[model samples]
Target: MDFSGKKVLITGASRGIGKATAMAFAEKGAQVGLNYRNNIDEAKRTLKEMPGKGHQLFQKDIGKTENCKELIQEFIETYGRLDILVNNAGIFQHHKIDEIDFEEWTQTWETTFRTNLYAAAHLSYWASQKMMKSGGGRIVNVSSRGAFRGEPNAPAYGASKAALNAMSQSLAKKLAPHNIFVGVVAPGFTETEMGANALTPEERERLLAETSFKRMAKPEEVAHAILFLASEGAEYCSGAIIDVNGASYLRS
Candidate 1:
């Protein structure tokens, strides 16, 4: 899909799937705004690696509600218009019920939900408003297979993504009449820094074995799904959730 003249904003673009998605959009001739909380170095590297120009970077902690609004505003100020918004920023933490104290448990849940769900919700709210006036736009949320298969060790992460999926569908219906589309891309374990850091060698091997491909997903594979959902002629798939797990998990 040629995104020439389109403007796209992607969160968590410093690395992994976010970085891949940002580069993909840029390569397709879209002006990209790369957002990252920390790791300015990596973010700069990603911006430099993009094939096209007009790719900018915004460093904001989206875990906060206000930051989400500010991020979208800053992006619009820089790019003039937002054609797509990819809510790819998320946090995954293990807070087992039996293993953590009440205070810690609550904190973990708050952080995870704020970063994973609330940020996306707030960003979408503002982005949709802009899209409404600009004629139309697309929003693609990066979810996880754990939302379906479960994350026993990271229940909050799993719960947050499930909520994200629900919220995306809800917005899909609400925004469709305005010509704005919302879709979701749920990927299994991907070969990213965060994914690798979350697993032990043994656990990694076991998880890979579960997939039909016997390997973890590459960040670009998930990016491809995100782009497809955001591409032209994909408005019909607004509320759909495309799985990129290589058959690791399935649900009817």
Candidate 2:
């Protein structure tokens, strides 16, 4: 599990699960590229907290195609090669069916898809090409339990995560021949900055009750699963989606 010379890039890495994942890699000796959109201060805080040196910060609005390409290119140029790509950047907006107007609903869908799914697709495309040239690499996608269980108020978010799972599987199969491994970690509600901002006291209580553990996952918990999927021995598990949902939702 040692990544002494590994170069990893994590998008949406300024805080929450992304930050935790970046730290996990850095602690294992990987040189990490932390990507954030608007939270420069928070991203800088994360950079300062990293365990190892040579970890760099990258600011990019991955929602745009050009930005996504640039983020990957910059990371490659800085580190020379990419060993892992973690697509953890995402946006969630509640565009309930009956409550929102058509325009609002459309906007939600467009923005959510661009940030959640399209960004991952574009980044993965460019990262995979670079990986192929350097022998091989790993791509670990951060999905959600909502992809399977559902997100009633945020239908677009649910749909995008589902699409991300499918995309990971597609790439896993396509990239296997080139020695690239792809896997997914689908986590339930984790106790992260985003979750803290989104959930109310009552909502948090209800979510806790719904889970078997009577609690939400910690960011570190999800990060451990992500690191495992990105490990060398996990090559045979390419295309696998490991659920880190604390038994909140089980799929047969």
CA RMSD, predictions in order: 0.7, 0.8
* Whole-model Cα lDDT of every candidate shown, in order: 0.94, 0.93
lDDT of 2: 0.93
Report the lDDT tens digits of candidate 1 across residue range 189-237: 9999999999989999999899879899999999999999999999999
Q: Which runs in model 1 stand beyond 4 Å of their true positions?
A: none
- Candidate 1, residue 186: Cα displacement in angstroms equals 0.3
* lDDT score for residue 135 of model 2: 99
When summed lDDT is taken over every stretch of 10 residues in candidate 2, the lowest stretch is 191-200
lDDT of 2 by residue, 1-252 (tens): 888999999999989999999999999999999999999999999999999799999999999899988898899899999999999998877788999999999999999999999999999999999999999999999999999989998999999999999999999999999999999999999998788776779988988998889889999999999999999898999999999988888899
